[model samples]
Target: MLKRLVSAWVWISTGLIALIWLPWMGLVWLFTARDPGRYSVGRWFRLAAVTVTRLNPFWKFRTTGVQIHDPRRPYVAVANHESLADIFLLSHLPWEMKWMSKDTIFRIPVMGWMMRMAGDVMVIRGDAGSRMRALEEARDRLRKRVSVMIMPEGTRSGGGELLKFHDGAFRLAIETGSPVLPIALAGTRHAIAKGSWLVGRARAIARVLPPVETAGMTLDDVPALREKVRTMIAEARTVLQRELAAAGA
Candidate 1:
């Protein structure tokens, strides 16, 4: 009962903020033509979402590990998707990365407008052409020295187990000669289930691992590269689970 009430209040505040931010974003976009990645505009948008997760007393979120500091280095950032809450945790990362969101998300009202103004890429599933277009956009961002983020699993693994990783992110890394950055997420599976209104108490942690260089990798090396990242994330997730357990989470 308490959790539900907190969720209700949080959603109200979050929605209100999103509604207000839409116009603000539009005004800003008009001036800067949407600032580049990791700029003030994008960071403000990320923090807006972080407000929702932080205001919830029932959830504890933390992000560990360091990102590459080279301003000219871009990577294909991939993470294991566990829940929508995972997004909030990701926004907590120090630098900004372009989110490869689904088309349906970009079709929403105020929320969608904010995402667009913030320069996120929209991907339409099952449409090969749309996917290709989205990939091109992501590639463009990477070339601009801005990282692109994708979930290799494509969807949340509700059972709290790793899913079969896809090859798109790997292919993107190799094709662009960008490194692959793996982020392992733990304790987010039940934070906010897809079809539920009640928020679950969770201790979520996002661990960003070192980048796997793909300087000379080719298409034939994608399979091996994919497994290598998945394995690294899996091991990190295991260690995070232990840490959460040790903390009584």
Candidate 2:
């Protein structure tokens, strides 16, 4: 209980600080950022999130195979959603990717405003018009060579297992002719469980698998593409668990 309190305090304090800093940074980004579509100002918030995770005595975050340095080659990055901590853990990767977050997240005060300034896509679940607009925005981002990150599961699993993926991400990849980058997240479920505020100590791993190209693929291929990427991430998650265990051993 004490540990959870400490972790929770760290997160809350960090969030409060972000509420102050993010908006200032957003203002600066307007003057300095080159492309509105590829604006990376929100990365400041993501970096702050990384710092919060690092300051928490209960969590260790790491990433692998994420050396996508080419600015010209944008991808449709998809990952399994295990816990809310997955967002911060994935941000540790070197490259930048626009997140396709739920519209509700975009309603949060400073954080939401930062997301808007960063050109992240937002979708309202069960709202077809919002979904279509989000898709169109994602496609436009890809065209501008900005990679987009999507959690295909639509929600956190709160467990290590992969949930059934939605078709929107895969369909977006097909429509944009972008490569699908499969990312596997392991151990986040132990860090912060869904529907709970308690935080726990854990080592989280994010593995970036090889990209699956959708150059010649069509809408008819979305289901197969989604399943294939889902399987790859699941297998990679299993491998990551073994690696984490061995490291601890």
Candidate 3:
């Protein structure tokens, strides 16, 4: 009962923070219209969520090995999606990247407004036209030297595990000749379970692994590239789960 009450407060706190932070971001949008990357403004938006993570006593999140010397050097950043909390975990990353999320997320009132203001890309699942358009938009972000973040799994797993990979992210990387940046996320599955509103206690970590350059890769290489990155993320996720478990113990 106590945990649930704290979780309730955490969610409420997140909502309140969003309400308070968004107005300032709206004002920022006016001046940053030409800067679609909106990197600085987006940073402020994510910091609001970071504030929630700090308020929640039952959740702990951190990042490791993310040293982007040139923040403008674009790469296709991919991660294994464990839960909704994965977004919060990645928010801990230092540099700003335009997130590729579902269109449903872009329809939310204030939250969706932030997504648009941040120049994030959104797609409808199973809609061919939407997928193509979203891909083109993501390519544009990369061309502008803004990294794009995507979850190849497309949906959250029940635990800190991966699903069958999709070709979109890898294909984009190869098409644009951008390197593939894999980030391994663990323990977030405990933060928020599938199809539930209640938050759970968790210690999550997002580990940025080395980048795999796709200088000469083509569409035929997407399959191999996709599995290679998936394997890399899976292995790192295994290590992170152990570290999180040991710390909790």
Top lDDT model: 3
* Cα RMSD to the true fold for all candidates: 1.7, 1.8, 1.2
In candidate 2, how many clashes are counted?
Answer: 0
- TM for every model, in the order presented, reads 0.94, 0.93, 0.96
Ordering by lDDT: 3, 1, 2
What's model 3's lDDT at 183?
A: 96
Which stretches of candidate 2 lie above 4 Å from their native place? none
lDDT of 2 at 184: 95
Error of 1 at 11 (Å): 1.2
Instruction: Please provide, for model 2 over 71-165, each residue's C-alpha lDDT reduced to its tens digit, 9 standing for 90 to 100.
Output: 55789999999888898899898777899999888998778877877788999988999989998999998888888899988887644567899
Q: Can you write out model 1's per-residue Cα lDDT over 1-249, one digit (the tens) per residue? A: 788798898789889889877777666667776445534556567888888787888888989997567745788999998888888889988787889999998998888888877778899988889888988999988977788899989887657789999999999999999999999999887688866777888998999999999998899999999999999999999999999999988
TM-score winner between 1 and 2, please give it: 1
Q: Give the TM-score of candidate 2.
A: 0.93
What lDDT tens digits, residue by residue, belong to model 3 across residues 70-182?
98899999999999998888998888888999988999888998888888899999999999999999999998889999999999766445799999999999999999999
Per-model C-alpha lDDT, please? Answer: 0.85, 0.84, 0.89
Best by TM-score: 3
TM-score of 3: 0.96
